[model samples]
Target: MEVLRTPDQRFAGLADFPFAPHYLEIANAGGPPLRIHYLDEGDKDSAPVLLLHGEPSWSYLYRHMVPPLAAYGHRVLAPDLIGFGRSDKPAARADYTFERHVDWMSAWLTALDLKDITLFCQDWGGLIGLRLVARFPERFARVVAANTGLPIGGGKAPLPFKLWVAFSQLVPRFPVGWLISKGTARGLTAAEKAAYDAPFPDERYKAGVRQFPLLVPITDAHASVAECKAAWQVLAQFEKPFVTAFSDGDPITRGGERILTERIPGTKGQPHTTIKNAGHFLQEDQPARLVAVINGDDAA
Candidate 1:
């Protein structure tokens, strides 16, 4: 697989993103090892709060929550998936796959040997992060699922999501920054939008970003449909403390949390909240509430 790494300079001097970058080499069976970048903050000895971002976004999405979570004496970890942020990007869209992502991240999890984890998963983060929970349930202590889902290709996807899938494919130029801004209630500042676009210098750098929307197993014929079905089997039995903090403004996943709360045993009796005046990218719209949810604050 031909791989492309974004120039180190693109990430320099991003506003409100002062955390240092950490790297790990993920071994690819038939290809050169790919580098995955992450942000590690706070007390290393404390149980980890793993923050996983989604498509077209990176660890930058968590800049607001990381500082406070770290300061609260919890270890905060946010990793850019192999094709996003500072991680190595494969040149071809075919190199990006749902199973490969799961494999890559699963390797990252075990390599770090993270245990007693508190997970905050949004967008693809929940899609991938929830699978991780099902794969390694003993490692997680609790979970906060936001604006995401683990689909088994069983139900009809929302019209907005269907429109998004079409748009992601049909758009001539994949505007990463503009796309993220549209997902949030308070649109990003120009600088913030540029931060979101930092990883991809040109269209070639966006093979992963371009491929993510299509990877969602929304239909029974899509790849990983059976895999997600299997993961749900495990998740249905997961009794860990799970909370859903969904935003009110997201059209795509507005009512999606119901599937999780209804199916996953872990969600029972939890403080599931509906964050008002926020959109799909609730982390950008309401990071403090997310931080409070992660910290188990009574007010959350």
Candidate 2:
């Protein structure tokens, strides 16, 4: 697979993203080795708090949430999932697949030998991260699911999701920054907007971004339907500390948090919150609340 690495200069001077980049190459991942970029902060030996982002956004999405969590005595590790952010981007959309995404992340997790994880996943982050938890439950200590879900392909896609899928494919230029801004409740500033656009200098670098929405399992014939069903089997038995922190303004994943709260054995009495005045990217709309939830700071 031909991969595109964004020019490091494109990432320079990014507003609010001050953490240095770290790399780990995934060897034998179908084709050439791909370097995954991540933000590793706070105490190295502290219990890991893994932050996973979804489509069109990267570790940069967690810039506001990372420092406080790190300061709260947790090692924060936020990674750019394969094609987004500073990670290597596969040149063609076909090179991106839901299973391959799972495999790549599984490799990255083992490579770091990270354990006793606290997962805060959103968007496609939940799609891939939840699978990791099901496949390797021992690695996780707890889960805080925000604006994400494990969708079984037996049902139809939500109307908003279907429209998003269509828009991603048909749009001439994949506007990364604009898309992120649109998803958040409050709009982004000029500099903040540019940072989201930083990873993809051009259209060729956005293949993964273009393909992520389509990878969501919405039909019985979808590529990931069977495995997603299998993952659900594992999750149904998950009794870890699970909490949901969905926003009030996202129509796309409006009712997704219920899947976890109602099904997962872990969420019996946990505090699940609806982030008011927030949208799909609550990290942008409600960063303090997100950070508070991640750090167990309910007072916020």
Candidate 3:
């Protein structure tokens, strides 16, 4: 697999993203070992709080939430999945797959040997992270499922997601920053918007972005359908603490949290919330609230 690593300069001076990059080399399904980049901050010995970002975005999505989480004395970890951020980006759109992503990140987890984890997963983060939880249930202590899901293609994906899948494929340009702004309730500043665009120097660097939307299983014939079904069987047995914090305004995932609160045995009696005035990217719009949720101070 031919891979493209974004030049280091594009990431310079990214506003509110000051953490130094840390990397780990992990074997992939094929080709050379890929380098996965992550931000490891705060007390190294403390239990980990793993934050996973989703499509067309990277660890930059969690910048605001990181400082507070780290300062609260938890080891905060945020990784830029391969093909996004400073991580190696495979050249072809066909290089990315749902199973490959799961494997790559599974490798990352085993590499770090992280335990007692509190996961904050959004978008594709949940798609992949939730699978990890089902497969490695002992590694996690609790979970925060924010605006994401593990779909098995048993039914049609939400209409907005379907529209996004079509748009991502047919659109003339994949505007990463503008796409992020459109998803946030408060939107982003010019600099913050630029930060989101920093990972992709040009269109060629966006193969992962271009391919992510199509990976969602909106039909029974999709590649990862059976895998997600097996994951669901495992998830139904995941009895650890589970909670959902979905935004009130996201058309794409507004009602999707019920899938977790209803299915996960651990979600029973947890004070799951619907964050008001937020959109698909709740971390951007409600970082403080998210932090409070993480600290277990969002009571009432």
Candidate 4:
């Protein structure tokens, strides 16, 4: 496992992102050393809110909400998963796997000694982050899931996800940043678009992007199915507080909130919301509404 770390110099002067970078070396030359980058905001002793981002996006996805959450007197920690943002990027598309992603993030959590955490997960963030919660429930305090799910691939995937999988495989250029903006209801500004594009300097840095779509467990027989099934077993028994705040316009994961609401015992009686005027990238389109959900003030 050869580890490749992107230099801090490569990420200098990103717009609206001035948070200092923190890295953890989770895996090493005994194999490939996995480097994970994260942003730590507010006082370290404050109650911790763990924010996780999904495919093609990094911790940068949480830029807008970080300050508000910090202002609310909670510490915020957002990590750039291996292969995204300022973290180490593996060279091959085959290097990324669902289980690997879980392990990468789980290691980061353990390294940071984060516990009793409130989790805000979206997109792949939910998929990977939920697995962390399920496996290590003692570490989590509460959860807010948005536009994400833990799919064990037992049935047909939603059509939009299937189309995305196909498009990711077939597209010649695989516009990493453009796809993110277009997937949202309001779209991104030229500056915001450039922020998303900052991580990948060229095609070489996009192995993670190209690999992420294929990593979704689309069939029941997928490799990570057993682990996800185990996580589901744990989640079924979860009695902690859980909430869902999904965007109304997200065709890709519109139905995922129902899975958490119905399956997780913790979701009972919680104020779940469907944010209007937002799409798959709800955090980008409606960050304030997302903050409202975190604060438990979204029209409960």
TM-score, structure 4 vs. true: 0.96
List candidate 4 segments past 4 Å from native: 28-30, 298-300
Clashing pairs in 3: none
The lDDT of model 4 is 0.85
Better of 2 and 3 by lDDT: 2
Pairs of residues at least 3 apart in sequence or in different chains that clash in candidate 1: none
Question: How do the residues 1-300 of candidate 1 rate in per-residue lDDT, one tens digit apiece?
Answer: 999999999999999999889999989867889999999999999999999999989999999999999989999999999889999999999999999999999999999999999999999999999999999999999999999999888667788888998999999999999999999999999999999999999999999999999999988878999999999999999999999999999888878899999998989998899988898899999999999999998588
Q: How far is candidate 3 from the true structure (C-alpha RMSD, Å)?
A: 1.0
Local accuracy of candidate 4 as per-residue lDDT tens digits, 30-84: 3567778899998799879999999989988899999998888889999998889
Once fitted onto the true fold, the runs of candidate 2 whose alpha carbons sit more than 4 angstroms away are 298-300
Model 1 worst lDDT window (10 residues): 153-162
Q: Model 1, residue 30: what's the lDDT? A: 70
Q: Tell me each candidate's TM-score.
A: 0.98, 0.98, 0.98, 0.96
Highest-scoring model, lDDT: 1
TM-score-better candidate, 1 vs 4: 1
Off by over 4 Å in 1: none
Q: Considering TM-score, where higher is better, how would the candidates rank from best to worst?
A: 1, 2, 3, 4
Clashes of 4: 3
Name the runs in model 3 displaced over 4 angstroms: 298-300
